[model samples]
Target: MEQTLRETIRNNPKKILGVNPNDAKVSLSYLTVAFVSLLIGGILGMLQGLERAGLIQLPSWLNYYQVLTAHGLLLLVVFTATFTIGYQYANLSHSFGGLLSKVRKLAWIGFALMLIGVVMVTVMIVLNEASVLYTFYPPLAAHPIFYIGLVFVVLGIWACCFGVFINYRYWRKNHPGQTTPILAFFAMGVFILWFFASIGVTIEVFTLIPWSMGLVETTNVMVGRTLFWWFGHTLVNIWYLVATSAWYVIVPKIIGGRHFSEKLIRLVIILLVILNIPGGFHHQIVDPGISQSVKFLHVFMSLSIAVPSLMTAFAMFFVLERTGRKLGGKGLLGWLKKLPWGDVRFLAPMIAMISFIPGGAGGIVNTSNQLNQVIHNTMWVVGHFHITVGVSVVLTFFGICYWLIPYLSKRQLTPKMNKIGVIQTYVWTVGMALMAGSMHIVGLLGDPRRTSDTTYGGHEIAVSWIPYEMVFAIGATLLLIGVIIQVYAVFNMMFFAPKGHTEFPVAEPEDDATPAPLWTERWGLWIVLLIAVISMAYVVPIVDMILNAPPGSPPIRTW
Candidate 1:
């Protein structure tokens, strides 16, 4: 039966179309998506960046709204979805003992559907038919077909979710009572998060589509935003969680050490599942409709979410320290000096950690209701997320691909260029640091986020910060160049690298390692449920206020 199944998978045209087509097939797919998505998104990002710098003329017909919408939706859909698919394919093959033919067919179907959705949305935006800024906040409506395209995108994501679940079940059946691989468990958590997080979008599509088509009189923006954040905030965590898993698996190997505490790592994952979902209300800090009490409750929970993130920092640093000590390094800073400085593995995590520091701090400030007043909708906001998601997560993705591609393709990376890529990683990190720092300062000085130009406190500020803007532009260019270099290196390794058939040494199978306990399995699902409960607890009364408060309820101020 196993033989027949393997043969079928190997022979099926659609199932095998993209699989192992060459040494670089899997890596190239992921790199291609990242490159293209970043390219498109980056162009829009550059416009936004330049506008913030006050260096560009605002074109009236540019339709900033549509550009913003397309940029956000495309990046979210392509960057996360494509990277997840590629990583999971490699992860499943290793974790599940082997990949099945059926799973491959499902993945292909999912990829195709996602591509169609991207095309539909892109075309709509280009035609100026949809300008809803990715939020699709109703009453600010878009073409019905825009919503339909989103449906296709979600459908495609659902297919990928099912594929992951099936693969998990298959692995568990074959290796009963064994602990699940950490990477597989993390992927499963993300899929489960998607299953629940997508509910809000699903509701929007079903009800809002009809409403937009003129079948209903009104659509509630408040309800939509609430439901949307329930999905949105958790989706961000989903991206962070997957990227963190790469950190967990790769950090130890890169530093040449073992995980400091497996149980602690698992516990953090559990906490992430629990806290990440409920904390979406932090995004609504500035909205007046929500009560102060409810907002405060979210503030408290948002601060709590930081605990696990800190725990991850601790675990990672501890492991690196241990690895340094093992290599005969001395004190606190001594370990840093001994790291394999030139290796992509070491460079990736190091840069990710450095970028995350400021990003995390900025996140704290933005989530505070009072503090948000100062920086909300400012360039600082842009700087924060780019560091967190763009610099940190994207860089780590490259790191993992760098390590994995060589192994999967049975080829060694071109040595000299790989080192150069590592150096460029630092250059990019420094550039972002300078750019984000300048943006934060300017934001405090009262520059608005997402605007082409602004006057603050009834006066037009001189272009005193043009120099900083120039520096930021330089940084942005350098960052792009760095990314391009990494892509070129990966491309060469994947396609043109001479395939000297070398069987890399595989790790010894762990007999004692049982599949992760079932009670601990699907932890992310329970986390989603908990988040829903918390969000509803805080959000229900806020909804009541919008629905029942007389023409003017006494403005409640708790801060």
Candidate 2:
């Protein structure tokens, strides 16, 4: 009787939606941390942007690199990751019918580990002992505790991943012949990718921790950089995975359209497994230590990544077109006019997709050794990153947060709040256009990235960069405003809003009657493919590094 009743409620689109509050303790805890991280990171980002603009000098107590480190860690690592895990937990809970009772211990323990790590790392950074910047590249070594803290955080998140996998494994056992729910399937695929991705950072952690403690005299720069990129690029890709899942699943419903082809979506997931790791070679395209043949192999692989992206574009745009037509759109291009402009839910993701066109193009260019010469370390790369992770992933996550949190907290998002959300997204898009556009142009004119010190000791070329930097600062101010608005809405809803229900935007596929292939649920096959591809891409390069490595360098303390 309970199972039959559950099936009835779960299948019904018209019924009240969202995960039960009792089932969302873990996600709520994570959302708290994630939102706070956004505030801290966003504020630091604004200061850094202003500093770069030369409008104001930084205070004596803090330097630009220190601020940069804090901003990157808080936004890129903490906010993006915590929010992804939180949302995925909520997603899995809804899919599994409720929180699996056995995983409660897993949730609390993982949260504890992450909290402790955050505190430790935050203290280290505040003391200015760990200003190595986010990448923590050696000989730019941070303190020992900072590295230890990073290990703790990664372990905590990995533990949560294990718990999710275990629960899903049990569910499959009990419910034979049933395919995993779509979100759950997406989560599992990402979980697999992240686990593989984690190996690189974990290896770095093991090496860095001991080295920081003086157990090792020197560390290999090539090895550290190679491992870092191995994890680094994939870390961003993990964010993409989380955001893309929502794009495929949630945005369609927001636009009043049915979901696109599950078969194609599944293929996209599979392609991610085969492509994401090997294609990370694009990150190291400018490094000369690796041979041209290896770089060429990765460039070819990098170009192949576009195939999956195009596939995604096709699937998403097709549904969007359908949604436009359903909303009374007509003609070949008329459907474009019919999209939900005022709704933040639809606008944010739509804007994200629009930004991705140029962002993805920049990525491909960076893969080319010759083309990368112009933009490799320039603000162009920064502009590209802002468009991809900054606008595309960041805005979409903001949109998800606006709705997802309200649903989980069982709080109604008032009409006023929704309007604010819409405004914030649009404001952000405009801000990014100004900042990123100028950044690209300035980069082509030879502006470097990663340093606040744009002045070349009164070099004539420095004068040319001032206007672009000023534009970036102005854009940053507007972007900060958007961040403030989002945080206000989210905090108000989570803590102080009246108790009320909100609908879960789970779009039923256009062809719900057609079953997804059984293999779509076979995560094991995807894992095998991922392993083979990673081995082919990494083993030779890593081995080459080990064989030809020079004596490693001693750690440097910038402070």
Best by lDDT: 2
Q: In the order shown, what is each candidate's alpha-carbon RMSD?
A: 5.7, 2.0
Output the lDDT of residue 33, model 2.
92
For each candidate in the order shown, give its overall lDDT on alpha carbons.
Answer: 0.69, 0.84
| Candidate 1 per-residue lDDT over residues 309-330, each given as its tens digit | 9998887787777778889889
**Least well predicted 10-residue stretch by lDDT in candidate 1:** 550-559
* lDDT score for residue 485 of model 2: 87
Candidate 2 C-alpha lDDT tens digits along 1-559:
9887687786532244557666566888888899889888888888888999998889767888888889888888889878888888888887777766767578777788888888788889988989988888888888899988888888888878887898789878977898887888888877778888888878987898888888899998888888888888888778888888899999988888888778778788878766787766787878869998998998888788788888888888888888899889999989999998888888888899889889988887888867988898899988999999999898888888767878888888787878888898988999999999999999998899988879888788988998999999998898888888888888888877777887778788776558777778777877888888889989999999989998988878977
lDDT of 1 at 344: 80
Model 1 C-alpha lDDT versus the unseen true structure:
0.69
> What stretches of model 1 exceed 4 Å from their correct place?
1-31, 58-63, 455-458, 462-467, 500-518, 522-559
Q: After superposition, how far is residue 454 of candidate 1 from its true place, in Å?
A: 2.7
Please give each candidate's TM-score: 0.86, 0.96
